[model samples]
Target: MNQVSSSNASLLGATFMLGAGITFAIINVITPIVTWQMGVPSTAVVFWQYVIATVFALPLIWRIGFGALKTRHPVAHEVRAFLSALGVQFFAFGFASGVPVWQMVALSMTGPFFIIAGATIFLGERLTVQRLGATIAGFAGALLVSQIGSEQFTWASILPVLAAACWGTVSVITKYLTRDEAPESLTLYMLVLITPNHFLIGLILGIAVAILPAGALPASLATGFDFMLPGGDALVLILLLGLVTAAAQYFLSLAYKVADATYLQPFDDLKLPLNIIAGWLVLGQVPGILFWPGVLLIIGASLFIMRQDRGRLPTGRSPIPETA
Candidate 1:
């Protein structure tokens, strides 16, 4: 491809990634609000949330089936992916456990840190000083935004951090495994294989928490769906939310093909501000004063990573190879 074509492709990919970031940010903002409105426990809410995602994955799997599995270790590699996904699911579930929303947003920004650490450990990638310093600064911002000194800390807070580590590992592993596989195949395998594991866990947790001595489960179930014509609006909203999420994932996949990961990743920092906006618009929850500084720090750190990665590339290097 010529320079003009490459630039255009990168621009298109960047646009898609921005869309994905916005959708994810909206999901992050609205999910907790939904859980609170539904009076469902965080875990239950998360379980249902994944159900929507799982539903979205089904059509994709149907579009590409066992034929693609022939190229990869259908069982083992899928299991690895699923396990990583489980960690992410746990993070989603923990989002509601009374932890402040702003704190969750700030701490989760450390995802880049874990991602960088994972690359170093798993892929033997060197950690540049700029990236390392930026990672540390990101966490410092998290601490400030979360007000670690003032708020009570609990195990729940650790889940997002662990999720980031797991996701980071997944990224390296995914890159390794998908060396010769199609993106459609990997996504399908992840959703189909991972869903069962998540479903089983959700079932166990749902039952465990539902059967509690008190009428908590019954109450949640009572308000769960309403199961009537009136609930059509709710169902439509859920489906729409899921569609938005799936669209985001699709765009992210497209972005990967057109732009370097480092270049595209810094754009993900857009999620924080978008989340704050979505929260305020949808749920009337604006971020606190500390959030502004924390967001700036995260953006700065992400930009540093992008710059460091770009610095390593050969001059005039293009992100995508020319077909002809």
Candidate 2:
């Protein structure tokens, strides 16, 4: 009976991971294709993306206890989480505007590094040497992808790095807040709280781009919200992307809730290959030899972390503290 249950759990974990990988890959490809092909401003595209994501998430929110956001001390943890989400929003838009899914997803592979830093600093956890080495290797790969060669480093290459850092922060923050809050409640707050924050960011960025001098906009930012709709096919793709986005967030929150950071961390490495494949299928992206090495570093680091969980928590549904 125990063996059967363990097998079942492993199957479920694989299913959840596959679902996450496919959804995220679809979103990454859809965002860029919609904005680039449809002639919609990047900001406008992002605005509609968030709007659609929120709408799609609504049914799930209602099915759960979303109204819990109205409870006392609502602003305490939720606000911080919302800010963390804003960083994710910026990364989403940034990738959509400038980078391909290959680079965006590749850079995002560095998230575990930020996770380790956040765990050590914010969650009072100790950092492992393996994690540190892996992070350094992953960052080095990022530097290469960004074209940060000896004498010519561009800001464009750096933005994705910042975006990955933000992603790591989101994971840590989610882990921290999910301690007392149920997964449904935490996801609910994230949806409701982040909606306004992202909306305001879109609005402000839109205004900034419009008012900025001609060269200023391109040199400093790529705005997406230009008050135009993508074509019919593009519109359809965006809607589908929204649905996928909603599901991904829900599953990710659930995973964080039901598992420890160390146990579940290895799964996040799956995104690297997923993105690589998406890039190949959608954009004819062919990664060079350097890409594989960097991916290996990220994956190796995640496995090391997972290996450390050998005896600390049970194999399935371990109630390890989410504070990290």
Per-prediction TM-score to the true structure, in the order listed: 0.77, 0.81
Segments in model 1 whose C-alpha atoms lie over 4 Å from true places: 57-59, 62-65, 71-76, 152-156, 179-182, 203-237, 311-324
User: How big is the positional error of residue 117 in model 2, measured in Å on the Cα after superposition?
Assistant: 2.1
Candidate 2 global lDDT = 0.62
Q: Model 2, stretches more than 4 Å misplaced?
A: 70-73, 76-81, 128-130, 145-147, 150-154, 210-214, 219-224, 253-264, 309-324
The residue-by-residue lDDT of candidate 2 on 1-324, one tens digit each, is: 488875665556656756677777777777667655554555555556666777977776687764666544476455555555555555555554556666667666666678789888998877777767766776776666554554434455455667667656766766666556555565566666665665677677778877877767653245535545566887787678667777776666556444444556567567767877887898887766566666566566657656763565333331111100
Estimate, for each residue in 1-324, the C-alpha lDDT of model 1 and write its tens digit: 899998998798779778777777666655565554644444444445555666775666577676766654666565555656566554564455544455565566666677688678876789877788999888777766665555566656665666655665565566556556666566656655554665565566556654556655434332332212214444554555566666666666667667766666656666666766766676677666776787678668867776776654322111110000
The whole-model lDDT of each prediction reads 0.60, 0.62
Worst 10 residues of 2 by lDDT: 315-324
Residue 126 local lDDT, model 1: 94
Candidate that would win on TM-score: 2
